[model samples]
Target: MTSFLERARSDIGTAPIAALNVGARRFSAHRDHAVEAFPAMDDMRDRAREIRLHTLANLDRYLAQFADTLEAAGGDVFFAADAREANDYVVQLARARGVQHIVKSKSMLTEELRLNDALEAEGMEVVETDLGELIVQLAKDRPSHIIAPVLHKTRFEVGALFEEKLGVPYTDDPIELNSIARRHLRPLFLTADMGISGVNVAVAQTGSICIVTNEGNGRLTTTAPRIHVAMLGAERLVPSIGDMSVILEVLARSATGQKLSVYTNVLTGPRRPGEPDGPDELHVVIVDNGRSKVLEGQGSEILACIRCGACLNVCPVYRTVGGHAYGSTYPGPVGSVLTPALFDLDEWSDLPYASTLCGACLEVCPVRIDIPRLLLGQRRLSVQTRTGPMWMRRPLRAYASAATHPRRFRALLRIGAAIGRLFRSGWILRLPWRGAAWTQGRDLQTPAKSFHRRWKGRNRGS
Candidate 1:
């Protein structure tokens, strides 16, 4: 398999990278404007953070309350320990119900579980109802970003994809593209036997799970199908409706700068007596999938992420390489901390190093996750475990030694300055040995005189 860095390097100046840059910048600007417009933004963010941390701390109690409430309201709750258990529960439910077609409403949890592949293996046709998800599904591509699944693709690329996949005339117009998707998905929604969605925030008090979306697919997916299975992460819960509302206040503004999403559906359970449109059976798969381990570990606060994708919009690395480069279900600054914390650190050690430690993600995060601190923690863990890049070890060891001793540091600085002065151009075209990678893209500047030398010279004259 290709490495994360390799994938990122390959897409540097590609069309997808260009598209990602434009979309991320637009979303970042909108979020800034939205935050500026909201008078209580800072206070709301503080409240949201408090709510998130509080809920996580008491997650066990809330999960039990939520399950009991939902189960009493004619819904079933399955606590899955991992991906296999989660997929098996959903597949078994489909089999028992004789479900032939499943329409999904952009559930990242399902993506993480690779639910579609599992269902397809069981001989069921699963369709993505969200427009971005539908486009990626049709193109047989994975989601690049959390909120905007196809952030890497431009309209022209989407048009081409639709034309080839749906046999429609190629049109780069977004309106026409949406129309094509709507026409194609309407029949599927009506025909699908099951609907799967990811929960934004679940209210333990009312047993209601919120699904925020920009399109009507969320509603259709939940209502049109006879069975609605919500793939909910265990951490995505609030103590009450008020807590859920507080999270909603920041989610949309941080995500797309909207006061609220176009469709914020709160479903308590299956259709009640005389309900007009809703599924007959409601299943909530409370997937743990390493979350329990995460909750017990150093990076537990990462579970507080609401999947707003605001951090991705502001991250310089994410903006340049897009989501595919991260090579995980989640990407960007949050992903750098999350993927490693939730999975094997040895495999994902490179992710934490991808950042510039600029703290842009924290600045834009609605819940104030302090992603940079988490990232540094991950990097520290990687080195402690000896799972980080082997090449960096020697250099960092040397740095540590020199930095701890003032005399050695000064001597190294003098040597560096002497080497720098050897080049009259004031720029090193390439560094020796392993450092060639550093100057490959741009030349390294010559080092100026050390501060110690300047201070000493001025003092001598005095």
Candidate 2:
């Protein structure tokens, strides 16, 4: 198994540059539109932050209120502690309903749970209705980016994928490709036994599940089947409609530069008796999946994310290596802080180090999440808890000890300069022990002298 850094280095070469160019261009448009649309963008973000903070602080009360209201409106609510529980609940529900096929909208929560795989394991065919998701699904690939699941695939690649998987004549034209997908998926929508979706914002006051999408799949997924299941992170809730509106204002602008997404559906319950369409049964599964634990520690601030994917688009590292490099459901800056927080730190310790800490992610984030600070905190926790490699910990500790003592520090600096001089070629080809890993892709040049020493000599000469 290749490591995260190794895989990232490989992808930097194999991933298409055109895909990255498209993402960059789209993100630039989003940034420009956000500036023009909201002159008080900063103020709006501050308010959004306040809303998240308040909602999280009172999350328990709000969750209870949401459940009671949803149940009163004839919807069943289930709280899942982890991925297994969430998957089991959905699978059991499908089994009870004898659901043979499921049509799904774009939902990162479902990805996090690996719900489709679970459902498939239980012998049900699941279809992804979102265009990007459909492409990835047809190719048997995982989503590479949060918002654009196929952001790393070019039109040519998608055309090939469609041809191979759907048996449609290959054409790289965007309009024709969309027409082909719509034609292929229409029957699935009409015949699906169940529909699964992800909730963007769950309004506690009104018991509403809100979803924002550029495509109409969300509406179809929720209404076309006899049973509708919507999954959401427990933290993805707002206290009232007013707070939801504030978030919506920033979400669309930050995500895709649209003043608002093409579709924003707010469903209060399943179909009512008088309703002409919608599922007969509605189930809302609120998944914790280690999020509550994040709230209990220094990582709680990460819950402020609205899943805009702005941080990913602006991150230099993500742009270079793409999302598959992280090897997690969420990728890029938010993923760096989030994966470790929501999962085992020892297993994912490498993710937190995958940033330049340039603060670009912070600048672009609509909710003002301090991603760099959180990443640093994760590093501190890893070292303090001895979860990091022993070799790394020993060197870091030695460096810290020496730097605290001026005499020792100066002596080490002189030794380093001497070593550099010994390497007459100017570059250190290899480092001893774990330090060797740092030079795998690039050479490290030995410093001729410390900056402090150079500055001291200049001052004396003057």
Best by TM-score: 1
Relative to the true structure, candidate 2 has a C-alpha RMSD (angstroms) of 2.9
Q: What is candidate 1's lDDT per residue for 103-215, written digit by digit as tens?
A: 99989999989999999999999988899999889888888888999988989999999899999999999999999999998999988999999999999999999999999
How many steric overlaps are in each model, in order?
0, 0
Report the lDDT tens digits of candidate 2 across residue range 1-462.
355787787788575645875776688676767768678778888999999999998999999999999999999999999999999999999999999999999999999999999999999999999999998888888888878898888889999988999898999999999999999999999999999999999999989999999988899999999999999899999999999999998898888887889999999988898889989999999999999999999789999899999988888888888888898999999999999899999988878888899999898888999999999999899988888645467889899999999999989887887787789988988888867867876789887666877799889957
Off by over 4 Å in 1: 398-414, 423-437, 440-443, 459-462
Q: Tell me each candidate's TM-score.
A: 0.95, 0.92
Candidate 1 Cα lDDT to native: 0.92
